[model samples]
Target: MKVFDIIIQAMLSLRSNLLRSWLTTMGVAVGVFSIIAVMTALQAIDRSVAAGLSSLGANTFEIQKYPAAFFGGHGRNRFINRPDITYEEGLAFKRLMQEEARNIGLKVSRSGNQATYRNRSTNPDVVMVGADENFTAANGFDIQQGRNLVEQDILYARNVILIGHEVYTTLFPQRSDPTEQLLRINDDVYRIIGILARKGAAFGQSQDNLVVIPITRYRAHIDSRQSVGITVEASSRSTYSSTLDQAVGAMRTARGLTIRQENDFELRTNESLVESFRDFRQTISIGAFIISFMALVTAGVGIMNIMLVSVTERTREIGIRKSIGAPGATILQQFLLEALFLSLTGGAIGIMAGTGAGNLIAIAFNLPPILPWLWIGIAIAVCSAIGISFGIFPAYKAASLDPVDALRAR
Candidate 1:
């Protein structure tokens, strides 16, 4: 009659039908895994996006030739055909927004560059950026040593450069001073004017594997035809909106767009980027939840079917117990406990497996290990509910059985 004794009985019953119990438990495990793995991966992506978005400074936005991202390929070709944001237009826009904005930077970038210092060379994956003096403030980069590029560097299109931390380490592994060191990229030899502070990886890509050169030099000696990206920073957060409007108007004027004509350039910012990611996360979450719900419903049905069979098989046992004065509530409690044990056991296995699987994605994204605690807690609660909801009917059926008829049955 003790609760512990009833608990022991419930566990014993499950042990006696180990194969059936395990099969039912697996159903529950699958359901939990479906949701947990998805959520874990999504959370990892969110973390990476949050970190990567910091690459753009506060109250800063970018104006480029195309949208930051395009999905489903619906209108991808339209963006491709849009005219490049010419270097001249970028300069004109900068001049127009100069008074309204705190700083305006014109930049262009090309990837797959190699930098050489003495005999040491960086991997060909290095990015070469053409930037103005305001690049560090407009972007979220800081010079750790030496000095930023001056107005004369851009004015005369000098062969001066700022090396990123990765380049610094790769080329100067001996801890030798990098300031004023001569380096070569392409056929152009340049002197390093500054050393950059390390900006850690974002979404598995190193942020410190590039070098910055004056936009003038980049256009003259580097890739002249490449589209330029303009970065504009607002003086204050309160003025960010007005600053963006002013920048947009300036860009429109620079591009010679009429009143009926649409602006040809794209506006990209950390806020817009985060909002896009949030929408993506929401869509994926909904899909995962639906799949998990279906799996859980199937698992619940499996639990109910197995419990019904258990009741039928134990009809004589139930009659004997009732004849000996065991209460219906006690029988119900034992059955419910058995179901709960099965569901919870499965959920534990699923949680561990899902976390491991999802973290594989996080590792690939270069993100740290993450535990989706909220999803885990929800899984536990859901398992408990499934067990009780599915097990109660069978328990009631067993408890209400007539002693005479149950004893007569085989």
Candidate 2:
């Protein structure tokens, strides 16, 4: 018999036990589904976060009291013990980098404040930030209406504020421009001088839900104990690296950190943040791979068991084929093909289902759809190998049956 004939016969044998074949295929399908679903969601989330992080601008870095992110207990304890970055220290650093850096901004933030304009009041989810004149340009925010904060606003601690896109929409739901309007923040009142353009969410947190006021005003009115963060912008793309180095030195000196003592402040740049996210992405990818691997192995085992049963039940038929002068190799090929057909069918079904399910989750999170073609190809190849590996023993057993003994047996 030709190879094609063997495959056809094998398929026919599988058709004789349709339910069992489908069950075996489903096992492999589930394995493919798990990894594909996870990968699709992860890819979408990564894209969304990358776009948000890019909005922080490539020429800027921030100096804060603690690291941008923390790991385990040791990491948390280390940052917790560090002193707060005070507003005075931020000013001193700014002065030291006067000639080297293009712009330096000092800022402090407090969250959970209700903004009220007459009887309309927002939820206590608003973030109120105290920022210097340079904050808007340094942080890559554009003034949509009216003007940005000026030096006089920060120096005199003026009662002026810049409302974010979300704040404007919430306070003035009619979509009217809110410039010059008096916004009541808690017990204090500030005139809105500008509105910020809409900035979407970053890491699942809305960037447009906060309000910005002069840092000097925030220190006097809000809590003075909170640390102030300093944002430094490089003079040019060529000077960015040297500028960062200078800022680091200036900050350490301003904070009075001796050479022997490690610097207590944290410096975060766009590249560093991207590198951190890359590491996190790798960890997630490894976990997904391991989980899928285990599932695929279990499915492969199912294929082996089912194929073994098939060989045993067809012993008499096998003997008759052997008696009719069919080659042992042909018998082996038929059994192996049957197992391969089961695995590949399951894999195809799994790929479709997994891709659809994964993309749906991405849509829910407002992320673009991601199709994992590479993983799909890998899955199909893996399924083929699994089918061959599991089918080998059963194929060899059927091929080795003695014709005389097999014919007399059942």
TM-score of 1: 0.89
Q: What are the per-residue Cα lDDT tens digits for candidate 2 across 1-410?
A: 98778878998999999999999999899888888887878778778778766776778899987766556565787788889998888889888998998888888998999898877888898999999989888888888888999999989999999999988888898988788889999999999999999978775467888999999889888878899899888988899999999988999999999999998988887776777777877888898889888888999999999999988898899999999999999999999898899999989988889899989988887677888888888988998998999889998999999999888877
lDDT of 1 by residue, 1-410 (tens): 79999999999999999999999999899989989998999888888887877767678899998776557467888888999999899889988987998888889999999999889999998999999998988887888999999899999999999999999999999878888879999778999989989998775678899999999999998779999999998999999999998888999999999999998889998877888888888889999899889999999999989999999999999889988999988998888888888889889988999999899988887777799999999999999999999988988888889988888879
Query: Considering every candidate listed, which one attains the maximal TM-score?
Result: 1
Pairs of residues clashing in candidate 2: none
Model 2 misplacement above 4 A:
1-19, 111-125, 170-173, 184-189, 317-334, 348-366, 399-409
By lDDT, the best candidate is 1
- The local lDDT score (0 to 100) that residue 50 gets in candidate 2 is 83
The Cα error of candidate 2 at residue 386, in Å, is 1.5
lDDT of 2: 0.87
**What is the TM-score of each predicted model, taking all chains together?**
0.89, 0.85
Clashing pairs in 1: none
